[model samples]
Target: MSEALASLLTALADDELILGHRHSEWTGFAPHIEEDVAFSSIAQDEIGHAAALYSLLAQRSGGDADGLALGRDAAAYRHAVLCERPNRDWAYTLARHWVYDTADAIRLEALHDTADEDLRALVTKMSREERYHLIHADAWIERVAAGPVEGRMKLEDGLKEAFEEALGLFEPIEHEEKAVHEGYLPLPSSELARRFRELAANKLDELGVQTEIYSRSDEAAEFVASSSGDLIASGDEHAESQPERARGLGGRSGHHSDEFQDLWDVMTSTYRNNPGATW
Candidate 1:
């Protein structure tokens, strides 16, 4: 596998893993029985996707799939901050679902035509599952944003709080330009980011929610700061730097937030305790 392919796969796998955990955290806590069952299924699919991706990535990483997935410290995980963030409320979780599904849809679309045959096949398989995930997200976003006043307030607050960290989901991979040039990715990361912003903003607008979108000129420069690592967003990146961004960064660069460490420890504790044990 190309180095770029490996790096991209690692980041993608971590995103799924952490987001799966977050979704699963709501398994019993979802607002209603129907939602509880629905979200639990979604959580299962996400975790399965992560495991499958990790298995493929292990071939290039030269490690056991389980070990690769289980042994990583919080700082070593390449998930976006949005995924690792502790869930605050149902609206917040739903907002994250909206942001993540939008980005993941584009990411998978870009990878569908990858130069690597194996990756292309895996992405193709994942795409079918993600279609349903997108539907789920769309339904929830409409429900929350178009619901009661409290629901509207929560959705608005959630978007404002999460909008910046969600940008972290599109953090550039090393040699990302090379990948696009070489036909590994469908388009430039900037284009995908633009699509995400437009979709999110348009959705919010349809619901009568006011959202400030980034100007076309602010695209590349705002998303990736030179001083920060390719995967890390600088602390200075906020709504002022662009539009709807936040100050926190560091997930794509593998430097997770402080809250992530506890979540990581809990998630890995069972596997760590019995590395060789099997179900």
Candidate 2:
């Protein structure tokens, strides 16, 4: 595979894998039994999608899919920081789910015309399942919006918190320009980001939710990922940095929040303990 294609695949797969793990965290703890089952099923689908993407990467890159998915170090993951965040509350979880699925749908739609036949076919397959996930997220979003004032407020707060970090979902990967130039990605990350913002705004407007979530200034270029997976200001030549400051930043470059280490440890424990073991 070309470097650009490999990077793109790795980013996509990592996002799915990490977010699926987060979704699975709600398996037993969801507010109700129906939600518990729903989230678990969604988690399974996401992880399955990750596995399929990794399998495609393995085929072209001569690597093991399991190894690619389970054996990578924390800093080696290319997921958006949003995916690795802890699900703090039902409202926040639903908010993040809606934003992510919306962006993911845009991404998959754009990939339908990719130059690579294999990738286009895989995208088509994934989109079939992803449609239901989008519906689930959209329904919950509308439900929360139409419910009690407190629930609506909390959901809005979640959107405010999640929207900025969600932008990292469209952060460019290494050699992304080449990928676009080659028709592997018909649209660039900037274009995708624009579409995400527009789509999100329209949806929120239609639902009578706050649409000011996109008003934040662009700070994406102000931070760089440190060696320890922390995000530090690019201009902070002499300033001390901490892992706690890593939110909403540096994910495309493999930088992650402190929470990622905990997630990584649990997610990879079995693979680390018994290398090459398979069920």
Candidate 3:
């Protein structure tokens, strides 16, 4: 169970870590400068959250957190598919931001009740910070979905398209059940996906965006590979193939998007060359 708890923590942290990298890509590319500042803060928040979670996992794994985060091969990461998908547009990004924050909030709430006192306390701290993220995302979802012209349609479409991938956010990594058995993390792995989807449906409806919500098995197969342009392209294939290995052809299984490798190269370039030097 301790090992399972560690894997579960690593999986959750990796999603935040990769998605934070994706969010950082918009540092100067957002439609509005003020929004750029606001979104950038969120990116930093996610990265910080990832760092804190990774620190705990590193302690458990008996390795350095930096290596755990940046040195691992793509196939070793256990982030959800939604986090790795490129932020093609502001609307799509916000759709994911809104949904993921809500889902994360609920998950953290469950974690706050764990029998492991330290883990419960850490999750409690995270839940406090997550309130701000939820506010920002909810405001954007409501305003965009309720106002404007073409933007509303685009936001709606983005929500619908990403809903399934968002559901994939709750997918379990290796040994999640052990965490439950040991009470290191509350909430049964089997029911977490369903509860996450239900919360999403309620939030989307309240924000005036309607979409279907679904679930996948914790051990469902990997995403199908695209033979054409990027799988993120509008017409690209989404749910087709299934790989036998956990680190298969998709983002969740540790296989990352092309963007992930590129991002990691840049993120670590400076740190790797100047190791042991003060920043």
Candidate 4:
């Protein structure tokens, strides 16, 4: 595979691997037995998908799938920051789930047209399983939206909290232009991001939630997270009072938050401890 294609595959696999771990965190702690089983199953599926992608990469790049999945340093991971964030609450978890899975669906749809037959086939298989995930997330979204006022409020709050980081899911990867030129990626991340915003806006409108979450100002590109975690536009006078935003920045370039380090240590400890061991 070309370096660009390898980078793209690594990014895709890393997203699934990290988010799979997050989903697994809920295995025994979900609100109900059904949810516990549901999340566990989803986690399994995600990890399996990651494994499949890594296997393809390994075949093309002459690397080990296990090494690709578990042996990478934290700074080498290309997943969106959204995938690495702690699941703060069920509402947030569901919100992130909806955002990530919906975006994944869009991504896979675009990948379905790729010139690479192996990747296209894999995407087709993954999309079949992903359809159920979408159904699960959409059902919960609708349930929370139609439930009590408190539930609706929490759901909305969670969506607002996750919205921007979700946008980072489409942050352009390194050499993405080459990937597009090679037909490895049929659509650029920006176009995919636009489609996601439109789809999300329609869904939120249908749910009676505010569509303002999808609105982005030109200054949004200038906004960066401060040391204190608040987002401030460069040279803006009221930087101190600006709300926290853009936690999803720089993930495509492998810059991650402190939370990722903590998660990474726990996640890689096993592999690091038994470097050559096989399961």
Candidate 5:
């Protein structure tokens, strides 16, 4: 019922929905049959995860899951820019998936100690599925990197292109501090971002890929590290200051692209005409 909890739920659910939609776009057009089947399954998994998160949010906020998912305006959705962006090429999807899923693994890990017992249990189950998601992403990443020059080049280009969007995955909203204070989340968004970068870098290194150096703002990094440390060490209300340097395309701030608006219209076409419509 708190702003922090709502933001977390909405953002997580939105990311899943958007990524699922993107993956679903490839259902009939994958590079091959096996990939098509695998991507379809992953798409289903992402949408199912979104449903689960939405259900938990509904329980906490006394809202209907269908309405929460199908009724939101484009500007109200809180997914990362990476998830909402078009799958420009297969390399882009692979890069985005690897980056997003790795960050997601870290994000979910930070929620293991959620104060809500039901949510904590849900996180446990969700983590199981997330592991496979990470595995799938990593496998493709490795395959492409270790394959032909064109494959490696494509993956590299995609990774560089999506780096900024990937950073958006951990952009903190105003109530993130409250979430940490209340034990709804164990780690602040800042720490999660650091862990994401580190983990992604490690994976790329293992695959023999040279990563582009991401520039960091000294002031922003200091504030995040300092504030994050204090919040973890002591439970208290902190300022609403967010990691602006990490913001990409303003997804977490409720701004979206035309691509997302189009996505929303298509996703909600049936429901818009009839709220009682069922899939």
Candidate 6:
């Protein structure tokens, strides 16, 4: 209920929402049809997670869930920069998938024990879905890391590039201190960034892949800036001042890059023409 906790919730929800949108772009377009189905499920789960968290946030923000989602200006979104980065290829996307889900597991595990009953409950439920995402990413990481020369090369290349971007997954929630103080979220005292990287490295090592990780203090900040540029510039609100106090990237805070305007136009085209119409 505190401002701090509410901010953290907004950050968490926005990240999931934007990332879900990025993932949806690959639907029916992935390399294999079966993989398409699998990827679609992950994308849907992310959106579902975002919606659930948004429902929680809406309770505090005093707005309907849909409004929290579709009505917000881009600057209001608090998702990390990595979530907005373009999905370059299947390998890169999968690399991102593996790293993100692993980091999320670490985060959710800590949250599941929070004193806030509602938050704890949401984390508990999301934990189940996260398990599937981890499995999906892990399976593909191994798959691409094996068998042929081309596959291995793609996996290695993708992991190399994505590993740096994946560090963005640790982008700090602005109200972290308050969230912890209020018992709304409980991240472990142990170094989560370190643990997450170690886990990811181990997974890659098992698959005969070697990844180079940058210093978190530097990489996370960089990812946020670059990814936000891609998301906001690709749309219409590219000229807004950066959302300095909002925390995280452009769209989540309302200062979206121009690209989001374009995306918003398409995403809301149908709804705009017929406000109350149903499919």
What TM-scores do the predictions have? 0.88, 0.89, 0.81, 0.90, 0.87, 0.79
Rank list by lDDT: 4, 2, 5, 1, 3, 6
Scored by lDDT, model 6 comes in at 0.68
Query: Candidate 3, which ten residues in sequence have the lowest lDDT sum?
Result: 228-237
Task: Give per-residue CA lDDT, model 4, range 161-228, as digits (tens).
Answer: 78867777887776778899999989988788778877888898999987666564223435444665
| lDDT tens readout by residue for model 2, 54-155 | 999999998788999989898899999999999999988998899899999999999999988888999999999889999999999999899999999999
- 71-154 per-residue lDDT for model 6 (tens digits): 665566666555766788987788777777888899888787787788889999999999989988888877777868897888
Off by over 4 Å in 4: 216-245
Q: Rate the local accuracy (lDDT) of all candidates.
A: 0.76, 0.85, 0.70, 0.85, 0.77, 0.68
Which regions in candidate 3 have their CA more than 4 angstroms from the true location?
212-252, 271-279
lDDT of 4: 0.85
The residue-level lDDT of candidate 1 at 218 comes to 31
Off by over 4 Å in 6: 188-190, 213-265, 268-279
Q: In model 2, where do residues sit more than 4 Å from their true spots?
A: 217-247
Q: Write the per-residue lDDT of candidate 5 for residues 163-208, one digit (tens) a residue.
A: 7567677777547779889888788877887887777777777887
Residue 257, candidate 5: Cα error in Å is 1.5
Better of 2 and 3 by lDDT: 2
Q: Which scores greater on TM-score, model 5 or model 6?
A: 5
TM for candidate 6 is 0.79
Q: Which residue pairs come into collision in candidate 4?
A: none
Tell me model 5's lDDT, rounded to 2 decimals: 0.77
- Clash numbers, per candidate: 1, 0, 0, 0, 0, 23
lDDT per residue, candidate 3, 1-279, as tens digits? 287777777887887888898888899999999999999998998888888888887776787778778767667887877787779899889888887787788778788788766567778777877889999998988888789878898887777656756646655555556777877667864367667666776776676664442222222322223343112212223323421222212453465667666766776777677766545
- Backbone clash pairs for candidate 5 read none
